[model samples]
Target: MDRIKFGTDGWRAVIAKDYTIDAVAKVAYATALWLTRKFKNPAAVIGYDCRFGGEMFMEAVAKILASKGIRVYIPEQFVTTPMVSLAVKKLKANCGIMISACNGPVNFNGYKLKGDHGGPMFEKDVKDIENLISEENEIDLELLNWNYMLEQGLIQYINLETIYMKEVRDNLSPEKFKASGLRIAFDAMFGSGQNLIKKLFPDEVSMHCVVNPSFHGVPPDPVRKNLNELSEWITHTRDIALGIALDGDADCVTLFDEKGNLIDANMILLLLIHYLAGYRQEEGKVVAGFSSTGKVRKICDHYAVPLIQSKIGFKEISRIMTEETVLVAGEESGGIALGDHLPERDGFWAGLMVALAIVDTGKSLKQLLKEVYSITGPFAFERVDLELNRIIRTRVIENCRNEVYQNFGSFKVIRTESLDGCKFYFSENQWLLIRPSGTEPLIRLYAEAETSDITLAIIEAARKTLVGEA
Candidate 1:
């Protein structure tokens, strides 16, 4: 058997491979042990998204926790990641477990942990749980009866979706949404981000909102490459104003403008900051992942709010959100958290907030972006995920570690930074970042420049710089 390990968020593996029932038992037992050791009567909130074997995995976790005498909170239907996070806080459970691969490809599944404060579990806690994975023991899960567990108060069903739905509706007004004269479109990408948006905006356009565990074989990541269909869905249509895509677990978000131009996370962050600070007069720190566009600093500076850069992953910024007063925090690949609400990323809320911003400013998405750029300046951003074999991936890391090349094809390296990954600066407004994925066997190359052409050129240059000699 392979030794189980966690990644940037949690344990994710291909279903029926490393993500089998026994593997889930091991992780769940470890979680049970950790909870029993940490709290006197540790209660847990558990849910799963629209993924393959979600119910099976949720049952495995519930039985394991029940056998260990821990209270388990679960839902009858599939729910989003944020729903479980919010339930953890509302139920005051010790921790939460969400069973979804969170935007990974259809063959994947994951176990995401949340703290009692409704955010990612602390790093130390995660490491402790990881260390306990090897200390697991065999258990007879079939011996546990669902009715008996329910009667014994070991497994209790909670309507986590209703919990999240009310919070989102309270913050948004359907009347105001209609008054804004802007049409909105949402693509759930066939993951758990369904139902609520339709309830909120009844007349808006929506697609892929059904429950398809396979996600139609499209990894539910909301990045631009995966969102071409959404772009085209809004374009050539009559007066559709905006397009929003949410991932499988509904924790990540991506948007498109009126013309179907992709509004990547970098632009989303800037627009959010502009709205939260300038329009709403909110105040506090803003945290962006290390791979985010540097223009975040400029916009935060314009708002006179401090910006903190965390390493890649939503958890790093979430930790700060739990302890500090963060107004906004985001990552390069569309995960965004509004600190005023919760420390976790709520893709549904993020989408509504974007709409709220549009309604508040009475402007189109492009006009709002133009206003943001007027302050932070314009920049195009792109991230390329390259699947590399062991040999080539190791070589790329070595090259980055040893400073193998000083320049790409034509872009000269002026400065370098390695907060979470190696970033090579070509000019004040242009840079390339090469970071290995903690959750997958891939390397992500990010580039930012004055235009989309330059951004693509930077990525191509970085690609050749790393693989030219391999």
Candidate 2:
């Protein structure tokens, strides 16, 4: 058996390879053991996204937990990661198991654990479960009948979407959003987030909202390159005011302006913070991942609100939100969690909050961005993922750890910081971050500059330098 290792979010592997039924059973058996050890009468909430083998995988999990005499609650249909997390909290389950790769490639599937607090399980707890996976705790998945377990009252079905939709409805005022005339469009990329978005705003333009386990032959990630269809649709449609996109599991978000320009997550963070302070008259600190743009500091400074920079994970930011009075916690990726809502990242919720900002302010998205620019100045951020083989990737990461890189092409490294990834600073306004993707075998190059062109140039230079050295 290939050893299962959890990454930034959870354990992911290529389906039919490492992500087989037997592999899932081992982890499920371990989770069942952990739950029994921690809780006297433990129950588990299980859900899955629109991934391949979702039903089969979820059944296998349910069977294992039920055979252990544990109560298992699973959604009647596919749901988003947020729904499963919320269900864990709402149902007061001991843990949540969401069978999703979460925006990964089609060939991959993953397991994400949610704590009872409606957010990701802490690092120590996830590690404990991973450590429990062994041959001694094997589960004979073939011997368990899923229908029999359901009949025996050990496994039950639930309607998580309705439960989750209520939470979303309570937080947002759809009437006001509809009245704003700032028409919004959504692209689900054929992942699980489609149903909720469609239910929330029925009239909004939608693309790839249907279920396609293969993700229409592309990864369901909400990155710029994979979102040209949505962008072009919004650009061509004169009435469309904004575009919101959710990734595979509906936990991450991507935004596009009226002109079909991709809005950086940093800008959205700034807008959310500014909205909370200016509109809602809220008071709390802001937590952002380390890879976030420096403009967040400017926003927090302008508002006199405290700021906390965590390592590169929504779970890291989510942990801080649970402990601190955070107004907003965001990652450089599309995940943003509002303190007023659940601690878990909800793409739909984040999208609505930003759109609400436009409604309450009576300004266009561009106008709102200009207002932010007047304070923080205009800046651009970009991330480039370079897929490399094992040999080169190992060499580059080892070199980064030893500080072997002094500069990249014409850009000198003025300073360096290693919180989650190795960050090389060229100046106050320019820097580059070199880190490997936790879910895939790719080195990520992140850059922030005075302009989009400059950000791309810096990333390109660094990419060439890193690969050349490797």
How much is 426 displaced in model 1, in angstroms?
1.1
TM-score per candidate, chains pooled = 0.97, 0.97
CA displacement after TM-score superposition, residue 337 of candidate 1 (Å): 0.8
Q: Please write out the lDDT profile of model 2 over residues 1-470, one tens digit for every residue.
A: 65788888899998999898888989999899899999988999999999999988999999999999899999888999999988998899999999999988899999999988889998888999999999654767778887799899999999999998898778788778887766888999999998876797888899898888988789999988899999999889977777899989999998988899888577788989888986688999999899999889988898999999999877787788889998998988888888988888888888888888888888888888888898898888988899888889888888889999998988999999999889999999999998888777899999999998889889989988977865
**Model 1 lDDT per residue over 1-470, tens place:** 67888788788999998889988998999999999999999999999998999999999999999999999999989999999999999889999999988988899999999989898888889999999886455677888788899998889988888888888767666568788778998999998888767767878889998898877778888876778887887887858777889989889888898899888778888999999999999988999999999999999988899999998887788899988899999987778999878898888788878888888888899999989889978788888888878788888877888888699999999988988878989998999998789899998898999998999998998877666666
Clash pairs, candidate 1, are none
Query: What value of lDDT does candidate 2 attain over all alpha carbons?
Result: 0.88
Candidate 1 segments exceeding 4 Å error: 135-137, 179-181
How much is 57 displaced in model 1, in angstroms? 0.4
Report every candidate's CA lDDT. 0.87, 0.88
